[model samples]
Target: MAIDSDYTVNSGVTTGVIGMQDPLYLAPGDISGLNPVASPFNDKHYLKWSRAVKMALISMNKVGFITGKYPKPAEIAATYQDWIKADYNVMCWILHSMIPEISESLLYVQSSKQLWDEIKDRYNQANAPFLYQLRKDVMHTIQENNQSVVNYFGKLTSV
Candidate 1:
């Protein structure tokens, strides 16, 4: 029996037909050793690092891997191995974007989605104390006569 353009297995999984240009497509030239971002994540700049990584992944068409859109296929599926390869490549890109200590701690994470979720969970906490301190600093900030308006605003926002 021939499969249709979109096929569904008895397991209730619908597999879409992917082409060579699909984001899920793992090209021969896609390497795992390259770091997409210029700076490694140092744990302090979670917001900045995450935005940079997201842009890089978006350019490479691999953002879906972390967002859990391109999930792994069943082991018996024809595209299972291809999905695994792409996932591994994405995982490497994420690891390479982090400092050695942070990456090493996450080395055992099984999938890119899991790794991404873990990192988000750890660094995305809301610190009331830190926020209060920043608010206080902003309130107390005074523009010195020597400081330019641009520099004064920059300092306030940088906090």
Candidate 2:
């Protein structure tokens, strides 16, 4: 028996080998809004919006683009072009999930990871002013006469 690019036999057992391209292949439909987050991120909904975006990216197996797990390759590397294309797709998905004002400000970002970090730093910070605002809103809450007791309670808890 002769061995080519196929299988090899060792100790009377045959093993098969396979070559796979990178998992970052993008379909035509994947070029546009991936609908990662149903509502555009408006700086006020970081926690809820980020969770939805992450789940969408995970579903597409593209979370690595934003997480830095798939680092960019050198310009001369064979995979560099493919990596860049996939990175752009991930960036587009993220941008489309954001409001125009926010996305436009990040238009020139070179990598998805950089954009992700920028947004995370700007919105995910736990600052005192934000906490103060939340406390104020909670303290000033008033239930309208037309509102049901359960609904009024929900509004307070949501704050």
Candidate 3:
């Protein structure tokens, strides 16, 4: 029996056609390009940008490529080279979407995991004073006499 790309087997017989889309394939504009919303130099904004980028990464299913958790294709597979090429292209596109200051430093780094770790290690440090200030802000926030309930709540949550 000859097998074709659209062939599907049912009960011991080749039956209906099955058109499979590649799960790893990412189309352009599937997700909006992430732009830096805040400067990494500002501690609060650094955290916000980090969160926004992380969310974008998660939505793209490309987070694993940067986290070192994505599976590698078997070396014997004929498409292994193509898979690697495609993955590398995706990684570069994501890396370039970051702020120029951050992305420039990462240009020389080939591995996505390395670039991700370097950024996280440099910016995602523990800061007791910053956290304390944020907590204080949240606690002291109260609905102003003129502020609507919804607006007040939004301000509190943002802090």
Candidate 4:
């Protein structure tokens, strides 16, 4: 089998084979919404919105930009700066779609990971109410008569 030039395999023997690439373009459809969470601080839809945003980033080959794991400057070519800038812009766009309070605080954040971590640390809480809600949801959930098995399973796991 031949590896595609557009895709590069990750290094490190124990890391296994993971392909990496830069997206040809970033499309609106790639992201499920123009704005994911209407009110991130409210802690209501953070889980769903975060998952959607993550999917969008993954599909765009930009997850590493947010995770602080991609395109190490020392390993990249001279054009690395351009790649960083592009990734940063995409990250900022995603952040701006979150909540005004959170987005405004990201003005001085230089890296995607910094912005990502801040939002995550602030809102990714697993407190008592959150746990109770999850338990309640799991207990009350029933496979609707018209719901597919796959959809039912997905709903169950999401909680």
Give the Cα error of residue 73 in candidate 2, in Å. Answer: 1.0
Candidates in order have lDDT scores of 0.82, 0.79, 0.60, 0.62
Please report the TM-score between candidate 4 and the true structure. 0.61
Order of models, best TM-score first: 1, 2, 3, 4
Model 3, backbone clash pairs (residues 3+ apart or across chains), number = 0
lDDT (tens digit, per residue) of candidate 2 on 7-81? 456997755442232335566677655657778998886887888988988877778889988888778544566
Per-residue lDDT of model 3, residues 100-141, tens digit only: 666677678655666667777877887998899989999999
List TM-score per model, in order: 0.73, 0.70, 0.62, 0.61
Better of 1 and 3 by TM-score: 1
Give the Å shift of residue 41 in candidate 4.
Answer: 7.9
Candidate 3 vs 4: which has more lDDT: 4
- Candidate 4 residue spans exceeding 4 A from truth: 1-20, 23-42, 71-77, 142-159
lDDT of 1 at 150: 99
Error (Å) of candidate 3 at residue 101 is 1.8
Could you tally the backbone clashes for each prediction? 0, 0, 0, 0
Against the true structure, whose lDDT is highest? 1
Report the lDDT tens digits of candidate 4 across residue range 1-159. 121223334563222222334432344454423453343434466677777777767767677767766644533443345456556666665766766666777767777777778778877887898788889999999999999999999999977
